[model samples]
Target: MSRTAPAPAGEAAPPRPRRRIPGLGALRESGRLFALAGTTVREAFRRPFQTRELIEQFWFVAAVTILPAALVSIPFGAVIALQVGSLAQQLGAQSFTGGASVLAVIQQASPLIVALLIAGAGGSAICADLGSRTIREELEAMEVMGVSPVQRLVVPRVLACMLVAVLLNGLVSVVGTLGGYFFNVMLQHGTPGAYLSSFSALAQLPDLYISEIKAVVFGFIAGVVAAYRGLNPRGGPKGVGDVVNQSVVITFLLLFVVNVVLTAIYLQLVPQKGA
Candidate 1:
């Protein structure tokens, strides 16, 4: 026994060197995201409206983001209107901006902005809350208590995030449309209501479908990226801060990539320009 003890030594295996592959990492991330999305849907249905957490989450995103996004978006619309307006008139196609601008803005920009807003509020929230729990070992305690943190803590928030995303997208579109409407009134001497009616008319069923679908995908990416960063953060407040930055940056980048692909898909799937 003493000889056996002398012959045995145990040490923690060296940490595997971290490796990252761009496309592979994204594909793996996509798989993880898909699982998280399933969990999110399950938790959302399980709790139903018991917690009011979903409502609170929606309010947090919409309220916190409304002002700045409002400020940014109206002008974005006006700018689009102004530029596109001139081009449309020059090309004798001034009546067509509704479909073009509304489709582009709602399907494309709205999702991106919503992702950024959630990244600032909900994404930061997921990181800070989870990171603090991690630092204090609350998550560990849950583990000891036989609760899987992912199931207990993450699933609900992930579901709430997707719900919040829907609301956020709606908020941005409304605010942006309104702002753009006002811009047309002020800049081009067009009535806001009339301009908006034009926009509404052009915002066809397919456009709404595209916009909503984009939101779901973008929201999923934002949720998973934020969750991954929060779950894998380095120790301490400094580390949490680092993770926050990483979460936002990665989510934004992924959101953009997704937006591009979704745009391409939309073009292929939606009715052609002339049709």
Candidate 2:
């Protein structure tokens, strides 16, 4: 006997196409983050304590960026000083240009700029590598075999970033100060002690403290964002390339936006009325 035919088009059918669920990917990603983060933390502490992975990751992230950050800071500082000096001169206040220069670099520019560089170069590299592995199912293979990819893959990078970015930012701040110091002290005939004094004067404890805070936060964000983007590529696997590029873009934009908001918050809390 012939089976009853299914309902015709435009009529009720045995079953409608399953409704496309919203955020299938997102829900999956959320679970992945939890799984990834949990495994990362566990492996982070599971070692004999202070293992080779931690050391290697620390070197990888921090060492690679040190030279670039140092090189960039010099020009960055010089440009800042020249621009601020020109503006001050026009306003008949050239005497205070050093103060302005130091303030510009340390207050927000130095650390924030450092964050951008590492986030673009170092962070994006991590994304590309991991994304490639993820798309090829290398991560899946690790999972199926009882290996934790997140622990081996994610934790080292994240830990590296927090350490490296801070160190890089510190280098940025120091080298930048030297550029301003040399320009003000050597070429312009300003006293070395006076230059140091001026720079030091501009950096109150609160300013330096806030700078450290910014470094850690931005570094952590860059690391986590890169890892997240990389581990969750799209297009069924061919999207790895785009994932790396997008990670860089997102890291940069997010860092810049966060920098602005942090600066505003600091200004409000610091109370400029007295000074």
Candidate 3:
């Protein structure tokens, strides 16, 4: 047996490196996500494209998302109409209700509602699917077979999400506008002619364009975030659930920030015109 003697008195061992703050860790993760998104984009346009997978993802996402989108848009439009109509009546600006409600729905509500549905319904589904595959070692087996999982698994999903988002945005805009019209005319006893007349009074071409742009951007963000969380899960069924939860939370936060930034830019570059 060998005996070691300690000769240090009043001397301390070296301190371990401190862990990064949670916020800093989140920033680092976000940087990694951005990098992953760039890589996905690069691989998306590569040869031997996965057209079948893209189509499958498109239908799957649409099937799951459409009902929720429709449900939410109707109530959303009704609420906006009710509130705006009441306010217009109070301010004696009833003639402007159509323009205000339509503008509000298209400019803000529709995109936000569609984004929420994408994140809550479609994003969670993606995360769960990929997370299960990850836990099952399917992704690892793909790597062993020299297949790029990002190209095979993520790119199609991302593209499909973007396509569906554009379509859903248009659907939501139409449905929400109709819902608002129904409420304004039937429930509030507003003149349908006035509502129809002022519908586009405060809107410009840019409004529709911006709404579509927002849908595409939000869809891309949600897809990338979900794929990142799913592909990087720790392990086990619980890990899948955790990743799904995190993906939704992260997507929501990102959407809110992106929406604010995009709205600010739109306001600066394309100010709303008078009725």
Whose TM-score is greatest here?
A: 3
List TM-scores for all candidates, in order: 0.77, 0.79, 0.92
Candidate 1: misplaced stretches above 4 Å?
1-56, 189-202
Rank order by TM-score, top first?
Answer: 3, 2, 1
- Per-residue alpha-carbon lDDT of candidate 3 for residues 1-275, written as tens digits (9 for 90 to 100): 99656548888756669987769977889799999999999999887899999999999999999999998999899999999999999999999899889988998999888888988888899999999999999999999999999999999998888988999999999999999999999998999888977875777899999999999999999899999999988769998899999999999999999999999999999867872
What is the C-alpha lDDT profile of model 1 across 28-56, one tens digit per residue? 86687667657655654553343564456
Q: Model 3, 213: alpha-carbon shift in Å?
A: 0.2
After TM-score superposition, what is the CA distance of residue 169 in candidate 3 from its true location, in Å? Answer: 0.7
| Native-to-model Cα distance after best TM-score fit, residue 45 in candidate 2, in Å | 5.6
- Candidate 3 clashing pairs, residues 3+ apart or interchain: none
Root-mean-square deviation per candidate: 6.2, 5.2, 3.9
Off by over 4 Å in 2: 1-50, 184-196, 235-238, 271-274
Candidate 3 ranges with C-alpha deviation above 4 Å: 1-22
The clash number for model 1 is 0
Q: On a 0 to 100 scale, what is the lDDT of residue 172 in model 3?
A: 95
